[model samples]
Target: MTTEQLTIFAILAITLGLFVWGRWRYDIVALLSLLAVGLFGLIPPQEMFAGLGHPAVITVAAVLVVSRGLLNAGLVDTLARHLTRVGEQPWIQVATLTSIVALSSGFINNVGALALFMPVAIWMSRKGGSSPSLLLMPLAFGSLLGGMLTMIGTPPNIIIATYRQESGGTPFGMFDFLPVGAAVTLAGLLFLSLIGWRLTPKRKEEQDTSKDLFEISAYLTELRVPKECKFAGRTLHDLMAAVKDDADMSVVGLVRSGKRKALPSIFEVLQEEDILLVESDSDSLKTLLDVTSLVLAAGEDQDQDQDEEKKKKKAGEWNLTEAIITHKSILVGKTTSALSVRERYGLNVLAVARQGHRLRERLGKLRLEAGDVLLVQGQEESLQSTLNELGCLPLASRGLRIGKPHKVLLSGGIFTVALALIALELLSATTALVGAALAMVMTGLVAKDEVYDSVDMPVIILLAAMLPVGQALETTGASDLIAQALLEIARSASPAIVLALLMTAVMLLSNLINNAAAAVIAAPIAIKMAQGMEASADPFLMTVAIGASCAFLTPIGHQSNALVMVPGGYRFGDYWRLGLPLSVLVLVVGVPMILWFWPL
Candidate 1:
């Protein structure tokens, strides 16, 4: 290898090591690698930041914003509501849920699609008396499968399209991916719904039932002391003494006149009308209320009064929702008390769950972390803004809102028009998606401020940063060298065998790194391999697209997989049990489908 190739390969080796080690965040690792290549003179300084402005990057960002718009408009929720009525059989429920997730993913961000359906899956699992593990993994896997169905479905497809464009060919059109993608998605869905779900380990009994999976009712509830309460003037310690031994409750905080005193002193005296945030179970809550004669602050009468007050003020329209913290979230490492969650944003943190465990720390004292699911109650408009500002993804609620049909139709119409524009070659994919996203904002389907928040920064950064690194591999002839090695291995084998091996290699790489990065690196090699074999580049390129989306066997492989791990109560090893078979099925089915659609 030449010196430049050696340098590129070494940088990639360390970068991949850090990614697999996972000690540092992926975006940070990617950015550092990008800078390293620039420092080594592999990538010209003028073109170092070009990836950030690439059409592929723009399309990914616009697609994410549009996905959020679809979510905010309740288009997916309306569909899920109907699916809930598709009978209670485990197989039927899994089939319906996975199918919807897969279909939605094709049009929007796959992770967002999975997030929208996760709560629905959990609710169905509870109703059907089955472990969420069975439904969640399939839902996640379906999201991955669905992304292959459209040009804008996943980042890898966009990356491949952009690569094709750079090679002096027209980028893949809107429906170019449909045939192979649809066939694979259909085959994968059939396996998951019928036999694959059964292969998932049953861990319902192993999960902690004390806390609900959704953390809806087990949240920290605020109770107000009524005038008729018997412990009106008693100190915090004295009141606790009354029910300390009888209930599993703790005084999390004391909120008086809208101000909070977290972890208040034991000698603090409680007055009538003081709202105490208590952490306890249902039975313990009832016992505490009976012992202290306290009433829930959110009781029916109070809620009605609050509603009336909201109408008068026109500012207190609050909603209860759950959000997961992303790696880029500013809230990480800061305690709720420090951030003044309630005081600053007019929001209340009801509960926080991390890695399937309900944190017992005082709500205010608990420091937020990436992947922590927070149950927050806040004003509807402000809540969405706050979660976005804090870098959190709001999980869709199980309850459907009124008038969803109108918003759903409006959002669907806008997205469909954009797709048509792309299909007709009237606009590029990026331009079309940007117009659609702006239309969603203008129609009030997605809030103006939320447009930027809808784009996942980590994903965008990962893709942009890795683009030049991929260029380095190509320019240094490293990609050509690797393709030749593969050609040698498959020299005697049939073209079909060569195609399967190439797909498997890309799939394995995708499971280790970001799928977008895998695609950027593997796409060039695929084209080179096709050239060496004197075959059309279409089949090899299609193989790269299919393999890049097949990120199964590890939670870290894809965001959708990671999103399901905590909620599903899945251990690291659990994914391989079902993912391995699904992957094999993809290779078994995908090769034939690709050759059929775009023959080599």
Candidate 2:
């Protein structure tokens, strides 16, 4: 009823609307909300930016760096070895795949862990002739489940743990999440591997050779420009204007006499002996040839080149491969032209595939997103390094490799020591992980230039920006008002039912917004709700942590879900089939587990 309460509520409502609308990135929206609160004098002006240096923010950045170090060390590669031989049945395959991803997630960033295993899962599905839809959803959910087991596994745990310290309690130790996190993970994994996978819609079978993930491979053709050709002296822009309306193709690249120009400008003038990389079907190719009098280059081998591209791919040589962009990828919001990807990374985006359909017509201007599979051309080594920097994962069937032996031993040693410090309570998590991340760079487990690149900045910004808003809620008594409302809704209910209601609210909020933001917003209300019930806040806080992590209902809920969308060939509706039941299972399991460990 107060002015401050109404102001904060209005701001939060708009924030939630923007998040669910997804018209803009979450970090940007958070920053805007931060500005709104400050301009309205919600929090102290001096304290408006204090959340930037918050321990939770720092720990998240450090964890991302540490995860990159482990990823670079090839730990996943070591675990991913011989996955195809694990099983043939769907249950066995799902169990093996989800187990590996889940275990990896407990130690590293769940999104990073999912990224590492995605290729392996895809390879297994194709090799065993099973529908990828059956395995990818399970693998994605497993990553979410796995992250619950450790403080650093997901950002929500870190946020809740740090909030505990901020609220006059000691920060949770690293392994404090293990008991509850592990139980939920076990139950969720069992459901996914056994019965959950059956609920997923089968997109296609691996045995169905008649179908393909993308039909663009047959459309790529190389044509040589003859001196007598009419379009020899004209720019590709002109040539495209002539044939583009009739053909769904683009000039992806051009090879000169001995030099290759990847992603040439549309205005670049063409010359004789130029090799034009045309993306078109047989009919389109003929039409183009007829219109321009361009002849097929002698060395141009479409069938052999595409089919055998993977076999001939090497890190040091120019080749073609498919890479999936992660949500953390710098290229997520920008177009290829803006980033100059070809010049910066020595690669070209030949085409893009979204949810199993090809979109190759305007690659140069396409704004990329997480889980988008890109048909890229570049040297394998350059691509390996660049994609690592760009937060992309090359498909496993392409045979790209990860991990460096000497760096592995060094980085592994550093990470182990950090975890030991946290477990022994010798050093705070922020200090230990920050020191370990520096060690990773110093010891060469991660590159010096890549030190900051490994950190997911948008996520850091989201956490930093939202913390103050959460503080504003508690500081202004808005949290208490909300908690009072919740208490009335659950009037006469036991503490257990109240806990379940809190978790359900958090879960629904998380599915609509970033999980970290969900935690930041819910933490204060959870504490207030506990105080209203004259119960301990520990259980309620822990409930926030658990509920925030169960963002299985929508792809927009978590990066792990979105990361698997395109590869799994899933649409918006597909997530709920398995996610809804798994979410119920998490609640049924997690509520009891939290009550046992941190009683109200």
Candidate 3:
């Protein structure tokens, strides 16, 4: 290998290793790799931040904002509520949910689209008297299927379109991916709803016992203080023994004189009518109330009226919620208390949940980390805004609101016009997308703030950093070298075998590295392979797109998989059971779909 190739490989390997280990954030890893390339003199210092201005990066960010706007407008939720009425049958429910998700993902951000419908699917499973595990895998897969349809539905599609523009000076139109993507999506959804969901292991069935997996059940209940209660004068620690003795109850906070206390210490003196935030089941709670000299309140409401009143006076009321921080987040290290989150951003750190283990005391003192779930309560508007600003993802489903569902036709019309304009080669894909985004803003379908709010900064940063790296790889003949090796290995194989092998290779690479990175490296190789075979490039390119996206075999392969891991209570080994077959199914169906549509 050449020195440049060796350097590029080393950087890519280190980046991928760090990403898989998940010790450092992904955007940080990408940025560090960019710096490494610069230090190695592979890329000029002047071009270090050029990826930020790349069309792919710009398009991805714009799409995120647009998707967020649509979500905020409630377009998906309106559709989701109706979609859940498909049927009582498990396969039918799964099929309907999957089909809806796939279709929705075609027009908006697939992740956002999935987020909108996940709650609906969860509710549907409950109503149908089944486990959420039966439906979530299909939901995620459906989102992936839908993302392949439109240009802005997924990052890979955006990257491929930009790559096309960079290479050929004319980008693929908005609907260019639909012919192949639609075919693959339909077949895959059919397989998942019918056969793929059945392959899931029985252990996944057991995990559905705890609907809210953050263990909130252990942190809510009734508490009392009697007239002769000596514990009234004692500190919070004096009551610690009583809490331990009561297995079902935990002390969340104190409510005194119809007022909420903020982060009370162990030595804080308790008074009469000071309610302790205890968590326990009905029996344990009754047992504790009987033993203690205190009488339980008639209503088991945790928050006092005065606390509610105070919250009402504020811009928005403070409410508790559980959320997980993403791997690419910026607010992973600092604690909410340390950051003065409440003071600065009007958010209070109520509790922190790390890997299913709940930390009761010193909740704010605990440092935050990626995958750490937090139970936070604060002013509604500020807290939601802060969560977005802090990069924390709410575990629960949020109701999406578009400005007006009444404007659905107008919103749809504007985007349709943009697509048509692009289809007719009247405007570049990037320009057309930007124009659609502008129309959405102008029509008030999305607000000004909504435009920037949807974009994930970390994802944008990662894309920007990796673009130059991809360019360097292609410029160094490394992508060519990798492609040549694959061709040589498949020299004796038939075209069908070669296509399958290429798909498998790309699929494996996506599992091992970033999917976008895999596509960048493999896309050119596919074009070269088609040239060598004296065939059309469209089939090969489409094959790479399909293969690069079907990374379900491992949790680390796709962010969607990582997202469902703890939420679904799945073990590391559980994914391969369903994922492997799904990947195989995609390969089986995708090959014929590509050949038939692109016609090599």
Per-residue lDDT of model 2, residues 511-542, tens digit only: 99999999999999998988898887888999
Output the better candidate (2/3) by TM-score: 2
Model 1 segments more than 4 A misplaced:
208-323, 375-405
Model 3, 1-600: lDDT tens digits are 899999988887888788778777677888898899889988888888998888888777767766765665566667765765687787998888889888988888877776666656656665666766777777887888787887777888888777765655366668888888887898889888889888764433444433444455444654667667878788765665564444334444567776665435556778888876664556667766665665665462544533453454352333456666766566577776467564466554545666445555454456777777666665455656777777776655222221235565676677778778877888876777777788788878788876766667777888889888777777777777877787898899877788999999988877766677677667777777776777877778778888888877777777776765655556677777887887887888888877887787
Better of 2 and 3 by lDDT: 2
Which rank order by TM-score, best down to worst?
2, 1, 3
lDDT score for residue 533 of model 3? 77
Q: Which residue pairs of candidate 2 clash? A: 315-380, 315-381
lDDT of each: 0.83, 0.84, 0.71
Of 1 and 2, the candidate ranking higher by lDDT: 2
What TM-score would candidate 2 get against the native? 0.87
Note each model's CA RMSD in angstroms: 6.0, 4.0, 5.8
Per-model clash counts, in order, read 0, 2, 11
